[model samples]
Target: MKVLVVEDERDISDSICQYLANEEFLCEAAYDYHSAMEKIHLYEYVCIILDITLPNGSGLDILKQLKDMQKAEGVIIISARNSLDDKIAGLKSGADDYLVKPFHLPELSARVAAIIRRRLFEGKNYITLDKLVLDIFKKTLKLDDIDIPLTRKEYELLLYFISNKNKVVTKESIVEHLWGSEMDLADSYNFIYSHIKNLRKKLIQAGSPDYIKVVYGMGYKFSIH
Candidate 1:
């Protein structure tokens, strides 16, 4: 899952990013309101860790912007403020949860996972599609009760494809989703082709019907029928 940590405190932001990254989440940081706004407008994330007090503006404004734009990303307010008004306001503004400062990283991670499950996976720990079962928390895939071992990248690719099943996904979008802004420095898209090929081969070997379909020059689509 992709998460955006919108915090002005360098230490807090870094710690959150590090912890979430270790938990197998793709994390990006925005240290101030301006940067946070830029990232919120530019990309899609499964969750947003927002600090209410920012350098240039309040994080509540960011929440309002998200609502205005009708973005579905889950928001979690993590701030030092412990006032009941703040908590109620944040929750009323569409934040999925709130965490007071000096909190445990594990708790934050759990909350993030819960919000992602609720928003993206319909509150389920696993996603079921025909004979395939994807364990979101464990990051494992099984085909007809048989485990299908996959590399980290392969697993992420498969999850991305399955999440957008039957819809054409562009190669650029795939690269951005997996590698984020770093894809801009990539010289070619050969890596995407390689990963997709490997994922397809493994799925087919695991007694699954071919679900990945190349869309000629466009990209690829995952469909069951």
Candidate 2:
């Protein structure tokens, strides 16, 4: 999943980013309201960890904007303010959950996962697409009831394809989703080719259908055709 962390605290933002990355999530950080606004306008995230207090603007305003615009992404409010009024206001402003500051990283991670499940997967812990199944909580993939071993990248690729099943996903989108901004410095898209090849081979070997398609110059697509 893709996440946006909007926090002014550099240490807190970096720590959250690192932990989210380790969980196989694409994370982007914004230190202030302007940066967060810019990012929200440019890309779509699965979730946003918003700080109610910001240097120039109130996090409540962001939440209100999201609510007014009816964005599909989930929002989790993290603030030092611990009051029923604050929590109620956040929820009233479309925040999915409220997390107080100085909390454990594990709890935050768990809340993020819960919100993602509710928003994207209909609150299901496992997702099944055709013959392939993904056990989200366990981080396991199964084909026809048999476990399929996959590298972290391979698993991420599979999940990405499944999430956008039957759609033509561009190679650039795939690259950006996987490597984020680093794709700009890469010399070639050969790495994408390698990962796709390995993932296809493994899925086929596991008795799963070949759903990924190449679109030549434009990009790749994740479709059953």
Candidate 3:
């Protein structure tokens, strides 16, 4: 999944991105308020790590904008000031969670995972789609209790499909979610097609139904109905 880290400090942002990258996320960084605004407007993320004190605006205002836009991305406020007022203010403004600065990176990752699990998988670590079962934390999938081997990209694609089940997810959005802004230079989505084809084949070979369906002139949808 994609995660946006809005922090003014280069070192902090770098560390956060590096850490989360290892945890299987395409991390995008915004150095200030303007960049954060632009990213939120242009892209969708699974979670956003926002700093309370920004270069030109308060993070609370950013949270407000998200609410105004009715974005579903979860927000976690990180602030240097450990004050009850700030926590309440951020929570009131619609932050899903808050963390004081000088926190451990593991704790940060755990919090991010929790928020994403709640947002994407409805707070479950495992997802069961009829005969198929996916363990989010273990990064494993099974069909009728038989292990289904999958490459990293295939697993991610399956997770993305299930996350937006029954909705048309465009090829462009899939590329962005998988590769982030770094894939701007790519010219085609052939790789995406190949991965999806292989994933669908594997699941079906493992005795699961063809859940991924192609939508002509649009993209694809994962549906049981």
Candidate 4:
């Protein structure tokens, strides 16, 4: 899953990213308020680890903006302050959870997982769609009791598709979700096409129906029908 760490302090931000990376999260960092705002506007993430203070603006303001946009991304506030007022204010401002700094990375990871579970997975580690079952914690997939191996990208793509099932997902959106800032380095979306093709083939080989459908000029849709 993708996560954004919006913290001005580079050392702390890097530490969070490194720890989360081991937990199978693709973490991206934003050093200051402007960059944080830009990233929140441009991309979507499973969860956002936001700092209370920033160089140019307040993270609470960013949280408010996100709520105003009706974005469903989960948010967890991390701050140096541990005052009851601060915690109450952050929760009132739409933060799903709050963490005081100088905390254990395991606790942070646990909190992040809790928020994601509550928001996206309904407190479960697996998601189901017909014959397919995706284990969120294990990062594994099964079709009709048969294990289906997936590359990390393929797994992410499948989860993305399942999360937005029956909706047309533009290739542009897929690229942004899968590659994030790295998309800037790509000359074309051939890699996306390649991944989807491989995923489709694997599912079919595993005796699963082709759930990924191309929508011609539009994009792809994953649906039972």
Candidate 5:
């Protein structure tokens, strides 16, 4: 999953990114309000770690923009102000969860995971489609009783495809979701084709139907029907 950390404190932001990265999440950091806005506008994240207090503007404003834009990315407010009012305001502004500054990294990670699970998997730990079963927490895919081994990138791609099943997903969006904002440095999207090819081969070999469909000049779609 991709996460954007909107924090002014360098130490806290770096710590969160490091911990989450170790847990296999792609993370990006924005120290101030303007940078945060730029990222939210440019990329899509599974979860956003937002601080209420920013250098030039309030994080609440960012939350408002997200709501106005109807972005589905989950938001978690991590603020030093632990007042009931702040928590209520954050929730009312569309934050899925709130965490105080002096919080443990593991708990924060768990909250982020839970939010992603609820948002993407409908609060379920596993997703079942046809004979295929995917364990979100375990990051494993199986065809009935047979296990299907996949690389990290393949697994992320599969999850993205499943989440948007039957919908056309552009290659640019796929790059942004998998690599975060760093995809700007990528030379080409040929790597996306490579990953898709491998994923298709594995699923086909595992006795699963070919659900991934190419959209010619546009992109790809995952359709079960």
Candidate 6:
């Protein structure tokens, strides 16, 4: 999965990114409100960790913008402002969960996972589509009871495709979702093609029917038919 960590504290932001990366998630950081705003608009993250106190603006503004944009990304409010009003306001503004500062990173990760499960997998830990089964926590993909080993990008790409299965996803959207706001350095779509090819190879080797369909001159789609 991919996540954006919008925090002003350099240490906290880096720590969160490191931890999530260790957990096999691609994480991007946004130090200030403006950067976070641009990121939130450009990328489609599975989740976002927003700190209420930013160098340039309140995280509340970020939350409001998220709601206004009708973004489907799960949000977790991580703030030193632990007042009841702040929590209330965050929930009212559409945050999925709230974590006070000084909390454990593992707990935060769990909460994010829970939100993803509820939102995307119908609250199931294992996601099954036809003969393909994926255990989100175990980080395992199986086809007809056979295991499939996937690289980090390949795993994330499979998840992205499954999440938007049957929908025509544009290359731009794929790039943004996979790389976040820092994709300016990615001048070519070669890396994306490579990842998709690898992911398809793994699935087919595992005895699963290929479902990732390339839409010529457009993008790709995941479908059983």
What is the per-residue lDDT of model 2 for residues 72-188, given as tens digits with 9 covering 90 to 100?
889999999999999999998889999998988888989999998887688999998887789987789998899999888788777777778777777777777677654573654
Q: Give the CA lDDT, 0 to 100, for residue 68 in model 5.
A: 95
Quote the lDDT for 10 in model 5: 97
Cα RMSDs, all models: 1.3, 2.1, 1.3, 1.5, 1.2, 1.6
Instruction: Estimate TM-scores for all models.
Output: 0.95, 0.90, 0.96, 0.94, 0.96, 0.93
lDDT of 4 at 156: 87
Arranged by lDDT with the best first, the candidates are: 5, 3, 4, 1, 6, 2
**TM-score, model 4 to reference:** 0.94
How do these models rank on TM-score, best leading?
A: 5, 3, 1, 4, 6, 2
Candidate 3: list runs displaced more than 4 Å: none
TM-score winner:
5
Alpha-carbon local distance difference test for all models:
0.90, 0.85, 0.92, 0.90, 0.94, 0.87
Supply the global lDDT for candidate 6.
0.87
> What clash count goes with each model?
0, 0, 0, 0, 0, 0
User: Candidate 2: TM-score?
Assistant: 0.90
Tens digits of per-residue lDDT, candidate 1, 14-83, equal: 9999999899888999999999989888888889999999999999999999999999899999999999
lDDT of 6 by residue, 27-128 (tens): 999999999998887678889999888888988889888888999999999988889999999989889999999999999989988998889888899988
Clashing residue pairs in candidate 1, if any? none
